[model samples]
Structure formats: C-alpha cells, structure tokens
Target: MSARITLASGVTLNTQIDGPDGAPWLILSNSLGADQSMWDEQIAFLSASYKVLRYDTRGHGQSDVPNGPYTFDDLVGDVIGLMDALSIETAHFMGLSMGGMTGLGLALRHPDRITKVVCADGRADAPAPFVGMWDQRMAAVKEGGLEAIADGTLGSWLTEDWRAANPARTKSVRDMVTATNVDGYVACCKALQKLDYLKSLGDVKIPVLFVGGSEDVGASPETMGAMAAATPGGRYVEIANAAHVANINAPEAFNDAIKGFLGV
Candidate 1:
C-alpha cells in the first residue's frame, strides 16, 4: 500500500508499505537524488520477513520539498514523526548515502525508535574534503542544475564496468537524478555539507552494520570500517566490485550482508 502521509512537521512524505501484516517493521531510506524505488530490488527479499516501510526523504521523490538548508534534526525528526503517525514504536532502519546518514542520526537522537541500523555507503563526519565536494556540487547545481552533476554522480555511484554492462539501468538512475527538484537537491547538499556525527558514534548502543562498496571512493571501505569500529557492536561488510550504490550494483551481496546482520 502507498500513500502521502503528513507528519507532525507538516511535511508530507510519500510512503509505501509492503510484506505480511503484523511482521516486524523495517524502514528503507533512499540516497540523495534517488527515491523509494531505489530499493525495489530488496523489496521482495526484505518484505518476506519484514513489514517493509519505504519512503522518499523530504525534497526527493514524491515527498514535500521544503525550503533550503535542511538539518540532521529535520531529517531525523521526519522519521520520528512518520513512525509516530503510523504508531510504529520501533523498527529496523536501513539507508544508503544520504539515507545512511539519516540512520546514524536516528541511532544517536532516537535510539529507542530503532532496534538496529544498516547504514550503507554513508559517512559519520564531513571533513574538509567532503565539505569541499558538496560545495562544488551545490555550486554546479545552482549554475547548471542537476544535469550538470548527473554524469559525475552516476559515475561515482556505479563502476565503469557495471555501468557499461547495465546501460538501461544506468540511464534510469541518471533520469532520476536529473528529475530531482533542484532546490531540494541543493538544500540536501547543504545538510550533507554540515555532517558531523563521527565524534558521537561511540554513544550508539545498538547494533549497526556499516556496508561499503570496495570501489566507493565517496564513502570508502576504510572509512566505513572505522565507523563500524567506533560504534558499539557494529559490523562492517565490504561488497566486492560495487560502488556508492552497492545495493543496486550488487543486490545479492548487499541482501546477504543485511540479512545476516538483521537475522531475518
């Protein structure tokens, strides 16, 4: 089932629910430019054992596109508000890239709301280089729109061999990137630029699985491994031959890693 639900924040998010009724809850969040459909491959596999809830983050997909300069508080509050609206006291959370960062924020700010977190291809902190990269991206988008950055984003998301072999899929993702609301994209970039959750990672008491692609330069395996080591009872899994969007580039390996971590 799918519907547009307005949260307490007055931001309406496009949400979809799947799987058997009364199953354990599992929430799936998308990356910066992508939507809920990014996890289409994992739906069947995950829904079999979980009541999967997939939603487009604010400013992406069919969700509300509020004004610029969204904060991690806004991002995390959106999830908390969504769960409260649905009466979901707790659920397992999984996200990639921007979505992954959301999971980390939830673990820190709302630990009671999530049992475990699968943060794939996400970082805990935005260092000087990371801030510089977002600055460049935001500037490009402001000047030439999302089209200017689509190619580079896609190239970073998937490896050359994978993109070459999966031309149609690659084009679809490119389309999604270009279709994003420019203002929303830039606003999200602003949030990403200010990421600073690394120092507080040790405060996360729940189990967290940090999944990284071997070829993902944006969130390298080394960085994810360090993040995993920082969090209590955290685990790290490196998907071979995958890039930033490892779930799309290597669904099987990604699914296996999450399944093992989630035990479902």
Candidate 2:
C-alpha cells in the first residue's frame, strides 16, 4: 500500500510498502527527477522475499517541494527519518544516481542503519566539467523548463536500441522527467554540484555492491568498479548495453546482480 509519512523535519515523503510485512526490510531510492515508480521493476522482483519500501524523495513525486539549494544531508536525513517513523532499525538499501549518493551518505553517517547497500549508476563527485554542464542545464530549465532537457536526458538515460524497442517505457521516463518539480530538480542539481563523497568510500564498512551501466557516461562502469574496490567489503557488476538507468534498461541483469549481492 502507498501512503504519506511526515518526518520530524516536517518533510512529508510519499511512500509505498509492499510484499510480506514480516520479511526483511529493503529500501529503494530513485534517481533525481524520478519518483518511487522508477523501482517498479525491482520492487516486483524483490518484494516476494523482501518487504520493500519505496518513497518519493522530498521534492520529486507526491512529496512536498521546499525552496531551492537543498543538501545531501537533507536527503540523507529524510531516509533515516522514514525508517524511524516506520520503526525499522535497519534495512538493505538500493539507490540510483542521486539516490545512490544518498545511500553513501546514509552508510557513512548512520552505518548501523543499513545492513547492505547497492549503489547503481552513482557518482561520488562532480567534476568541474560536469558542474558546468549542470549549470547549463539549470539555466536552460530556468528558460525552457524541464522539457528543454527532456530529449537530452532520455538520450543519455537509455540505449538507442532500448528506447526504440520500448516506446511505452521511454514515454513513461520522459513524462517522469517532464513532470518533475523544477524547484526540486534545480536544488538537487546545486547539491550535486557541491558533492564530494568519493573520498569517504573507504569509511563504509558494511557489505556494499556497485552496479554500473556499460554505456553510462555519467557513472561509468570503470568508475563504479573502482569505488567498489576502494571499500573494505565491496563488489561490482556492470550491465552491458545499458545506459544511465541500468535498472530499467537492463532489469534482468540488474536483478540478477542484486540477488547475487544479497546472497553474499
């Protein structure tokens, strides 16, 4: 069932919980500009054995959009607050893009809260060139809105073959991107610009898995693999022919990788 949960910080996050209620807890966090629906595929596959929890981040889906210039701390706090509200002391977390970054922060600050973590297509830092690109996107959004970047985003998010073969899914992703709250999107962009969490990878002690898309320019497979190698107990996997959103573009492989990670 889906409902809204308000945190102590007064941020109300839209959440959906499914599967056997008594099962182990697992949290699915979505990418920037995406809501909980991004994990629909993963949820369906995992929920049978895991009590899955998926929530729209503070400003993305059915959640409230506060003012601009949010921080990773705010994002991390929201997830912890949600767990507390639901009386879950710990959970296995899986996140993509911005969501993955949040998992990193959560594992760092509240290591005990996460039993394991899967960071998919997540970058640990934003280089100057990427920051410049983000700045350009922010300016374009201010002028032409999310639509201005919709095509470009779609192009990067999925492989050409996947987009051509799955028009319905492509449309769904495009709509999700276009429907994103502008203020929230820009705030996240700014937060990403200031992110520098790569140096803290060694601090993460729990079992960690990093999944990357072979074709993802944003978070290349090599980079994700390097992150996994840096951690004390980390592993890496890459989905071939996948782009930025590997979980959607290559769900079968993604699910297999996740299941293997959990088995370890």
* Highest-TM-score candidate: 1
Candidate 2, 50-121: lDDT as tens digits: 999999987799998978798999999999999999999999999999999898888888888998889999
- TM-score, per-candidate, Cα-based: 0.98, 0.98
Residues forming the 10-long window of minimal summed lDDT in candidate 1: 255-264
Report how far off residue 11 is in candidate 1 (Å): 0.4
**Residues 1-264, candidate 1, lDDT per residue (tens digit)?**
999999987999999999999999999999999999999989999999999999999999999999979988889899999999999999999999999999999999888889999999999998899999899888999899889999999999999999999999999999999989888898998899889999999999888999999999989999999999999988899999999999999999999888888877
Task: Assess each prediction's global lDDT (C-alpha) against the native.
Answer: 0.93, 0.90
Error of 2 at 240 (Å): 0.6
- Candidate 1's TM-score reads 0.98
Clash count, predicted structure 2: 0
List runs of model 1 lying over 4 Å from the truth. none
